[model samples]
Target: MRVPVELDPDVDDEAPTGDTITVYDKRHYVTYLRLLDAKAEGADWKEVAQTVLHRDPVADEFRTRRCWQSHLQRAQWLSREGYRKILEQAVANKL
Candidate 1:
């Protein structure tokens, strides 16, 4: 999937939690993928926060870690469950 160029660099301290995907999830689709990839590769959270989430770990450790953890959790959820919703939407659109 293409990384969305228009995605906002700023991330919320905590990602939204729900059974259904939100507009925030759609907007940060690429961010979620990147976070997943980083996790799989054993990338450090500090580096991931700085590079992927655009947060300064040194400047705000607590907030940065919170954002990373929340986003990573959301990313995993997207991989495990949210993709099904996306597929359903795609199929619905094609019908």
Candidate 2:
């Protein structure tokens, strides 16, 4: 999707707590899909971080790993809980 890798420093590392969809979630939908796929295929985090998430592991190992892990966790959360709200939003938008 050629999505930009400009991670917002202000956004929390954790996913939204409630059944609410945020602009960040909407923007990173493709990213979430990529993450979910990578995880299901057992792809290495280093590869996923640099290739998918576009973070340089060599420059900052800790931040790169943390970002990858946090985002993957959030993606999993979205699959389990957040997609319902997003579906509702889509239905509302169509109406």
Candidate 3:
């Protein structure tokens, strides 16, 4: 597993999209984990946006929602497919 980096409360309006991981993914790994944990606990998107992404849902609902959704989707992608890439890299490093 990757060591946790400093948390960045700042988030983009939209997350990086694509099959492969990107630098944004590496930077926002903690954000992705928080998003996933909140989701599993059935937290509201608005709450997640405000708490995890540090966006004001009421002040900018559209942007906040967009950012939350994109990040959540990316988080799910990481759990499902992106984790394999991380594990592969870890194993390769050990070799």
lDDT, candidates in the order shown: 0.87, 0.75, 0.88
- Residues 28-71 of candidate 3 have per-residue lDDT tens digits of 99999999999999999998899999999999999899899999
Q: Rank the candidates by lDDT, best first.
A: 3, 1, 2
Q: Please write out the lDDT profile of model 2 over residues 1-95, one tens digit for every residue.
A: 22344433333444444557776776677777888999999998899888877787899889888888888887888999888887887788789
- Candidate 1: tens digits of C-alpha lDDT, residues 10-90: 788889898886777877888898999999999999999999899999999998999999999999999999899988876
Model 3 residue runs over 4 Å out of place are: 1-4
Report RMSD (Å) for each prediction in the order shown.
3.2, 5.0, 2.4
Kindly report which residue pairs in candidate 3 clash with one another. none
Off by over 4 Å in 1: 1-8
Locate the minimum summed-lDDT window of 10 residues in model 3: 1-10
lDDT of 2: 0.75
